[model samples]
Target: MINICFKQSSSKILGFNIEGHAEYGEEGEDIVCSAVSALSYTIVNGITEVLKISVEHIIKDGFLQLSLRDNNLEEIEKCQVLLETMLLGFKSMEIGYGDYIKVQVEEV
Candidate 1:
């Protein structure tokens, strides 16, 4: 299963941690995993390249973690839309593939 946890402070998103694989199909044909990866990379690129915000991230097999490098509320706010969109995508996936994915939100 793919486990995703979003961390927030004062109702603002701070970052997220995602680990595991859907294992719903053969590696290359796992649509769940592919969707997750595409959304993740899009948000990462949107924040780091488009928004020009510094971020701390770790990418590895079946794992991806990302956090705003600075805690500045304004900077963090800039990422909300993209992050929230990612959340929506994940939630939608969970609805369809509950057996393969889990989503959680945590107050930090």
Candidate 2:
């Protein structure tokens, strides 16, 4: 299952931790996983490449984690929209694949 967790600092969403994979089918043929991978990679690439924001991240087989390198709200504000939209996409995915994906919000 893919677990998407949004971290909150005070009332604002700081960043997120996305880990695991939704083993719904064979790796290459899983549409659910495809959608998620596309969206997740897009956001991560956008933030670090297009948006040129420094980020802390980790990646391994079946897992990926990402966070802003700096915690200052001002620094985060630079990519706030992208981060929130990423979570929104993840939540939408959960609506359809709740059995294989989990979405949660946590205070950090």
Candidate 3:
């Protein structure tokens, strides 16, 4: 299962961590995995590219993370929309692929 977790700080989304695979099908054929991957990558790109936020993150085999290094309230608040949109996408996937994905939000 893919574990999708959001880290929050004082009502703001600091970042998100994604790990594991959906295992819904073979790698290239897994719709669940593909959807999640697309959403995750879009989140990283959208924030950095469109919002111009500098993200501190890690990317590796079966894992991807994204977060902001800037703690300014305005920047964090700006990121909230993108992060919450990502979470909603993940939740939509979870609803469809209940056996293949799990979502969580954690306070940091």
Candidate topping TM-score: 1
What local lDDT score does residue 106 receive in model 3, on the 0 to 100 scale? Answer: 94
Say what the RMSD of model 3 is: 1.2
For every model shown, the clashing-pair count is 0, 0, 0
User: What ranking of all candidate models by lDDT puts the best one first?
Assistant: 1, 3, 2
Between the candidate structures 2 and 3, which one is better when assessed by TM-score? 3
lDDT tens digits, residues 19-87, model 2?
787889998998878888889789889888997877888777777788763656676887778878888
Error (Å) of candidate 2 at residue 36 is 1.4
lDDT of 3 by residue, 1-108 (tens): 999999987877898899999899997999998898888898888888999978788988789988764557787888888899998988888888999999999998
In angstroms, how far off is 20's CA in candidate 3? 0.3
Best of the two (1, 3) by lDDT: 1
Looking at model 3, the pairs that clash are none
Best of the two (1, 2) by lDDT: 1
lDDT of each: 0.93, 0.81, 0.87
Which segments of candidate 1 are over 4 A away from where they belong? Answer: none
Assess candidate 1 and give its TM-score to the true structure: 0.96
